[model samples]
Each structure stands twice: as C-alpha cells, then as structure tokens.
Target: MLTRHFLALLFLLAFAPPGTCGPVKILMLGTSLTQGYGLPPGVEIPALLQAKLKAAGVDSKVINAGVSGDTSTDAASRLDWSLADHPDAAIVEVGSNDALRGIPPAETERSISTILAKLEAQHVPTLLLGMKAPRNLGSAYVRSFDAIYPRLAKRYGTMLYPFLLEGVVLNPKLNQADGMHPNPAGAKIIAEHIFPYAKALVRKARVRRTAK
Candidate 1:
C-alpha cells in the first residue's frame, strides 16, 4: 500500500498540469532585444526574466517570441500565430525598429493597438514595454512615438514599462560592440529592472486563470 501511494504521488508530480506543479506560461513578444540579437538565445531578456521570476518564488515559464528586426507592424501581423502556442500571458516590446526606421508613429501605434486588442480578446493578460526615440527624432516625433505605449497600455488596461532599455541603453559597457544591442550583462540589468513588474503580471494572470 505504501509503495502504491508513493508511485501515485510521483506520477502526479511529474505529469501534473501547469497550475498544479509547474510554472506559468508567459509569452514574450518583441524584436532583436527580446530575441537576444548578437547573443545566445538563453541570454536574452525573456530567459533572464524567467530566472528572476523563479528566484522571486514564482514558478513561471517565459517563451521568447522575439524576432530580429521585427517592427510593430510585423508583431501585429504575427500576434495570432504567436498566441496559438497558448501562453497564459504576454509581454509586448516592439516599436524600436519602427522608430529606428522612422516608420511614422501613427502606424506604430495602430499596430500596437491592434496587437493588444487581439490579446485582450483571447483573455490573455499583457505587459507593454515602451520605447523612446532618440532626441534626433525631434520633439514632434518624440511626442508621437512616446505616446503610443502609454496610450495603448491605458486603453487595454495592461502593465507598462515606460522604457524597456532604461538602465542598460546608455551604458557603453553594457551594450554590444554595435552599441545597438545589449550584451549578456546588459540583459541581466534589464531582467532585474523588469522582474517585479513581470512577476506581478504573472501573478495576476494566474489568479484570473484560477478564477476561471
């Protein structure tokens, strides 16, 4: 009888569903930054974020859906396909490429808005990582570009990280040789900065999932 009970427990622990024993599933959506361009796949922000969340005692899985050079338009188009993987939550971090390519802030906003709407429709919670343009973009472009994230986060009721590259962008040592992407150290900084916010998003999503 004891042996049978132990075997049953082992099976339950091994094959239990997500809510039972394993971590929550979170989909991270973005561009090269999220994809860890110029760096190994596991060194990206999403993986580091997962590590941080685990450290914080929240069991969670962060799926990296970042594609190199993906613009807001690209992300919007791929939203459905990405969500088909059945992530419990999502973090959106596009628009940098759009800003870099000078793709018109209005178009970027529209794309992000569309993406958020689709995620919302699927009842997937989300976190938005906003991006800012270089001062060279001029005041008009800056205002338009910077407003897209907050506007969408508010409209969709999602958590927003004002600047995805907050502490890592300006640091030369943190950035890669190209000065566009972050090295592993820089990715760690980003993970640390975004960890709490991501944890909260995950916890909330878990609660909602449980309620349902």
Candidate 2:
C-alpha cells in the first residue's frame, strides 16, 4: 500500500497539469507528412506525438494542420488562418511541394522566412523541418533549396529537424504507393524520432508558464 501510494504521488508530480491553460497546445503545420498521408486517423505524426507526450508524463495537445501538396507559398498565404488557434508552438514543414513543382529555391526561402518571421513576432515557439530538393532539380537548386531551413532556423533561433522524414522517406517499405508519403509504420518511425524534441519544447513551455 505504501509503495502504491508513493508511485501514485510520483505520477501526479510528473504529469501534473501546467498552470492556467492546463495543457500545452502544439500546432503541426506541414504537408501530407503531418496529415499522416497514407495512414489512418490517429496514426499520423501529430496523433503519435500527442500519445508519446502523454506516455512521457507531459500534458499536451497537438493540432494537425497539414494539407496535401502545400508549398511554402501556400502556407504563407494561409498563415494567418492557421494561427487562429493561437498555439503554444508550431512545427513548420513546407518546401517539399516547392521543390516538386520546380519553384525557385529563392522564392521558397522567402516565403518560409516570412512565415517564420510572423510567428516569431508573436513569440510562438517553432520547429522547422527541412526537406531535400529533388535530385533532378540539379546541384545548384539543391544547394540553394536545402540550405533554407538551417539558415532560417539560425536567423529565427528555431529548432530544426533537418529532414522531417529522415528515417522513412527513402525506405521503400516505409512509404505509401505513390512514393511520396509515409505509411503507418513509417509514420511511427517519424513520431519516434521527433517525439523527444517536441516533448522537451512543451515541457519548457510549461516551465515558462509556471515561472510567470
């Protein structure tokens, strides 16, 4: 009985609700990757991330704002609409469609930079996901496009995931039939890799809230 009570107390302390809002709200703003693409509902990165946070004793909410084939330009246009919820943080994953549609790398960078700037002005924490340029786009485009995320991250002091699908994109077994998005298993891999960083961000937010 003593041990049981002790464990319960520990659990309560570890998963204690944060002040005021009660739960950290995170917005995942990306493309099909955030939407879970080929996977069913609740199996996507957002859902998986929420579950991972819960298991880690972090109380948080993850909002999925992914649209298929969305480019940085599209995201920039929709940025205000997406901010309606006033999330505690956001994970930005644009540029894939920009690369696929042969949009100028400079254009992609400009749009994404604008997006980040607006979010930063609001003091919303952000995690940037970088995507590689398609090989066919040529080395010049690749260098220019691929460097966008890191550069923007440095400028904005945002956390960067390097490549959103680092472990799942190239693996045949992890992708869907169209070879663009991840299947359920692939989403799991993505969730596992990104979960830690996201949880840390949420916990840090909770700390800040408490300190205030």
Candidate with best TM-score:
1
lDDT of 1 by residue, 1-212 (tens): 99999999998778755554457889999999999898876788999998888887888899999999999999999988988888888999999999999999999999999999999998888999999997798999999899888888999999999999998887899999988899999999898888989988988788767766
Weakest 10 consecutive residues of candidate 1 by summed lDDT: 15-24
lDDT of 1 at 67: 96
Instruction: Give a tens-digit lDDT track for model 2, residues 1-212.
Output: 99999999888888755444568888888887777777887898899999999998888889999998888988899889989987888889899999999999999999999999999987888888889987888999999999999999999999988988787877889988888888888889988989878976786666656665
Error of 2 at 46 (Å): 0.4
Show where candidate 1 strays beyond 4 Å. Answer: 1-21
Estimate the lDDT of model 2: 0.86
Instruction: Give me the candidate number with maximum lDDT.
Output: 1
Mark the regions of model 2 whose C-alpha exceeds 4 Å error after superposition: 1-19
Error of 1 at 183 (Å): 1.1
Angstrom error at residue 29, model 1: 0.5
Clashing pairs in 1: none
Task: Report the lDDT of model 1 for residue 181.
Answer: 94
Per-model TM against the reference:
0.90, 0.88
